[model samples]
Target: MSPERGRPPRRAVVRAARRGLGYMPGTLLIAAVAGVLGLSLGAGGVPDVVPAGGGLTVNDVTSKAFGQHAPGLPIGELRHFTIGNRLFNTNWVIAPASVRSLDGLGPYFNRVSCSACHVRDGRGRPPAGPEAPMMSMLVRLSVPGPDGTPAAHPIYGEQLSDRAVEGLAPEGRAAMTWEPLAPFVYADGSVVPLRRPRLDFVDMADGPLGPGAMTSARVANAVFGLGLLEAVSEAHVVARADPDDANGDGVSGRVNRVWDHDAQALALGRFGWKANQPTLRQQAAAAMAGDVGVTSEHFAGGNYTAAQTDAAALPNGADDEGVELSRKQLNRLTFYLQTLAVPARRDTHNPVVQRGEQLFGAAGCNACHTPVMQTGATAAHGVLVDQTFAPYTDLLLHDMGPGLADGRPDGLASGREWRTPALWGLGLQKRVSGHTFLLHDGRARNAQEAVLWHGGEARGARDRFARWPAEDRAALLAFLDSL
Candidate 1:
């Protein structure tokens, strides 16, 4: 399919919103919530507080908020966490180096280490423009496959690696140019400028990205609270799959069934922008192979296409098991991700944030971004089991419409679908990663832009948000920041 095939027109979106397509009134939604929870939205009462990560929540608001380990962890566990942290930040060199473990750097890869992209364990931002290099972002490429699956491009493989090891040339560099979309206008006559990214592949090592190639550029997301998300039982997540929208809420969410290397079977995908990886361990291992070109047990062998002989023939710093990353090392890295703490919500008592909380429910943002979920008893770590947490997501896939579409499919997710990202620790994005770029490709510049870019199943909530008065919108954003 053409990249622009399914994209809805800007004017059509506005007219549909005006026509009340999937739009829910604020009063009716609030009344429904009040009826179900038996809770008052009255002026005198404050909603009870729920820990953002259950026992794993931290109380830091500073720059290090996203980097903290879960509090009250045992000393032995902390030791493993420290080692994993070191490995995550380690910069790998070329193969045959003195340090055997840290050697086997990419013949073709995006960054030097995990920290290079996910700076401080927080979100990553796209380059300022075509002039700047993509330091913290990467591009995915594929051609149409036989059975609706994505096949890796013959020369560049699944990902574009702009940087290569010393001797060989890099695959290619991706430059982004922003095309301005029509400014979104509120009911009160306020206008917000919006832009979408246009990607161009330049300075190719082998050859051009031939015809029929589909590409999707994505910025790295935050790495915290993933273990908690993984612990949410598959049954619990599957129960929320209203694929047919049987309730007639105009919102249908379903799970992505993806390959699990460990289990050797299809499992619920709960990580990545499209929910493509089933577990944090597989997610980490895939990142090692794709982003850093380090081989692991989960993904063995060099990250090279058969066409790139030099890259494929490089000497690897593989251990006895024939992979650059050992099983023990992978275990430590997975443990690090599994035990990272989620930052607690701040400024809950502020009246603006409080008002925003009510508007959030009124706008039906809580339907997909479910405020609460409970982890089951099967987590490997005791701290992650049977805990109620407020991560602000249902861990399900939803069709976000063509406005935010990449026209790239993965696993069971279509071009129009994306996993609802957790909104926890959103406000501190700038302090931690130095920018507020949101969405899969960093197209949305802030939380408000992120909301306005919503469509498909979220059109109702997005339109309801746009129709609100300025004060109500501010309160809703303030409530989001509080998370």
Candidate 2:
């Protein structure tokens, strides 16, 4: 008999029960064994299952799950969290509105609010088709510059904004067309079709994006667990760096050191698709400048290039107050992002999930999708201090091969490198954001497709997945879903 996609075989269930019941009292163990065998247990005979998120995880599975505050936030900080939530969800308008706080949107920008891209604190998907406009995703533009840094495109600057304020033309619109490739065959004769994206720039206001410009398509990632990722000790993350692959494990992970605006020095980057932003505060500030066309203390000037003189000349709301986003407001939004809770893993006790967990490690997925890390003392938020979390990422950049390359270098990350994304809330992405697209650009249609796209350092793990029997493949996916 074959195991169901999400249900483990009966034998697997029995094995899991025996293993989990070792410390149970005699009567409880007997009843657990009976339950595993499908014997009816009387009232009060059920065993207590351990919850996921290791106490930090929330059990909500609804669309609103990602928007919740972290469990156990101090009572005193609740008001601040609520204020931040309102600010995060507030839509910024063109400058000089009745409401002073929510004004100063872009003279040139992508979306009006942070929630526009994150979409309920969840992932963003690519455009549905060629006619679809890019709303939640943006294209990063750069060229090779001095000291291994990326030079902003002379005309477009760092990002291409497809929308602009009244009377001003947008830089350009971004469109995508997909080209299908030959179907990939597995060892067991199963096949998977793959598609690659072709990005097109249309209606350029300044002129042609010079042939030398390098572009990377980036989809907005989920906002949960960021504070925890931020809380991870720099020394601990650095300790995992193996840029030279000294162990010959076929995996070489490198650290991305970037400018920390508050620290006023170079610091290890742990945010963004390429790990280009050093801290969440700076990440928020960059988003304000680049995504919303709003200026803050970190980016006092609007995101306009010298070529965008028209945009630069626009009356920035900041001229009245000196900056668009105030220090208090920025801190509130940052706090809101820092406190979003990680959704608890569902169906963790199921036998199929257990089997999948074992297979995950066996396939060498753990080599880069590191399953565990401990948070050190976090000065930004006390809620994240000294917590052990399973974010399932090393937060280091790895060469994912030409298959997923954007041909754009960011900070120290090569064209083919991307920071390992956290897998904690992956299963709920479709539920929260209404899409299952994965990868940096939301190219992969599902987790399976995401795995098939892996290459370079992850070639061995990808091959292991490809070579697995259909049942094992289902098991592996089930394990990931449980997370």
| Tens digits of lDDT, candidate 1, 275-375 | 99999999999999999999999889789999999987778889899999998899999999999999999888766665667667778898899888889
lDDT agreement of model 1 with the native: 0.86
**7 Cα displacement, candidate 2 (Å):** 4.2
> What are the TM-scores, per candidate, against the unseen true structure?
0.92, 0.90
Give me the displacement of residue 160 in model 2, in angstroms.
Answer: 0.6
Q: Which candidate number maximizes lDDT?
A: 1
lDDT of 2: 0.82
Using TM-score, give the best candidate's number. 1
**TM-score, cand. 2:** 0.90
Query: Candidate 2, 36: how far from true, in Å?
Result: 28
Query: What TM-score does prediction 1 earn?
Result: 0.92
**What residue runs in model 2 are displaced by over 4 Å at the alpha carbon?**
1-55, 146-148, 319-321
